[model samples]
Target: MFVHFGLYAVAARHEWVMNREEIEAERYARYADVFDPDLFDAAALARTAKQAGARYVVLTAKHHEGFCLWDTATTDFSAAEALMAMCRELQPHMIVNDRLGIPGDLVTPEQYQPSRPLERDGVPVLWEACQTAPRDAALFAAIGEWMHRHRRAVHGAGPSAFTAPSGVTYTQRGDRLYACLFDWPFGLLHLPDLAGRVRFARLLHDGSELRMREIPQAQQAFNMNPAAPPPGTLTLTLPTRKPEVALPVIELLLWDSP
Candidate 1:
């Protein structure tokens, strides 16, 4: 909670001048008369904070100078109430500190009164700890380790650069290939560019085997050019309807490398 006001307002310095300059309480109190924060509008501040994408804003009602910005029974000088009224009117969801003699939603208890863990019903994990930079190095390493443990079952070492049909992506390493289907295809699914020694093909998600047909490159009209490599395609027979699950992956075991 930091608001810039009081003697420092006229001094044009930080708000901690009374203590820094060793000014007497009586002499420092003189700024109260001149401390009219005419330009202070909490609604404008709230709007600025919202535009800046700030989750919350804290105002310094009282700095180390011991000046009260809000009208309190203890003092006659306080423009805080007006600013607070503007803030409440503009952003009702704004979080305010308790220093303004106002009740707050969060409580900052002293040591020995630690807060208990919060939970969300039905959801196993509710909270996420967001850390950055040097602190997240270990987190990145852990993710790599997790991926290493599941490497063999994955499509490839990296994602494919070539484009595929909607909801379809394939990974290839040498002769071994794997296909990931985010959406089920009705009837026969064709791969126009797959050219290699055909081998066993099956659905990876479940151990179910799928029948596949290969169009010989020499028989196709596109492979008629002698300079061009034989143009062939692999076709997979698919069910008309999708399975219960959302995405299904298929694995193709090739006998030889292309």
Candidate 2:
């Protein structure tokens, strides 16, 4: 929360009193005479700042009044220290932005999407992605609801984490992986990573089971014995060319071994 309270409050005009009025520093200092400490309640202001979703608050100190509200050696009342102490006592968890003459949290980056998730010391850090969507989130909720309602055999499937190629996304609930295909592939939707991990595959939109085959890429001349392919490069043969729905989602029951 930004509290722009200072000598400007009594000025009744603007915070830039000296600059706008062309008053000298010595003349502007006279505004401090009217500064009434009785009028300002720091604790009440801090409470209001918290209710406004402000994790932190910044106060306007040493404003156009030329009166040093805090950090003064002449008076016992160090307004800066007192105000901050009051804010800390009232809202202990509240962060104080730099405007209060304090060091703050890490520098925040906004309005951009990173190629990969941001991490510090190998730990993921909170980052923002700049993406525009319909202001009404109900559209997204409706789409998710439709997918959940038609989950069918793939409902409550899991392996927790699995890999799929680009343009595809998957969800795991119990023992099944529901792969939502955004674009229709040619003849086969090859899941190279799931070569040995998947036992069965089926179209979740319909209850039709799919046929799958595993082929090795590494082979020699007249290769009687083909070398075993690495994990996550296996291929599955899908029966249907395409599903009737606009976005086709398939369900695969994973296997433990090849």
Please name the candidate that would achieve the greatest TM-score relative to the true structure.
2
Please give, for residues 204-233, the per-residue lDDT of candidate 1 as tens digits: 646678887765445534442222223566
Please list the Cα RMSD from the true structure of every candidate, rounded to 1 decimal place: 19.6, 12.9
lDDT of 2: 0.60
The lowest-lDDT stretch of 10 consecutive residues in candidate 2 is 128-137
Q: CA lDDT, every prediction?
A: 0.57, 0.60
Sequence-dependent TM-score of model 2: 0.40
Q: Could you give candidate 2's per-residue lDDT for residues 159-258 as a string of tens digits?
A: 2356667777766756577787887776566675776677788777666877776665665426444344455565555654676665777777876522
Clashes of each: 2, 11
Task: For candidate 1, give the lDDT of residue 38.
Answer: 79
TM-score of each: 0.34, 0.40
TM-score of candidate 1 relative to the true fold: 0.34
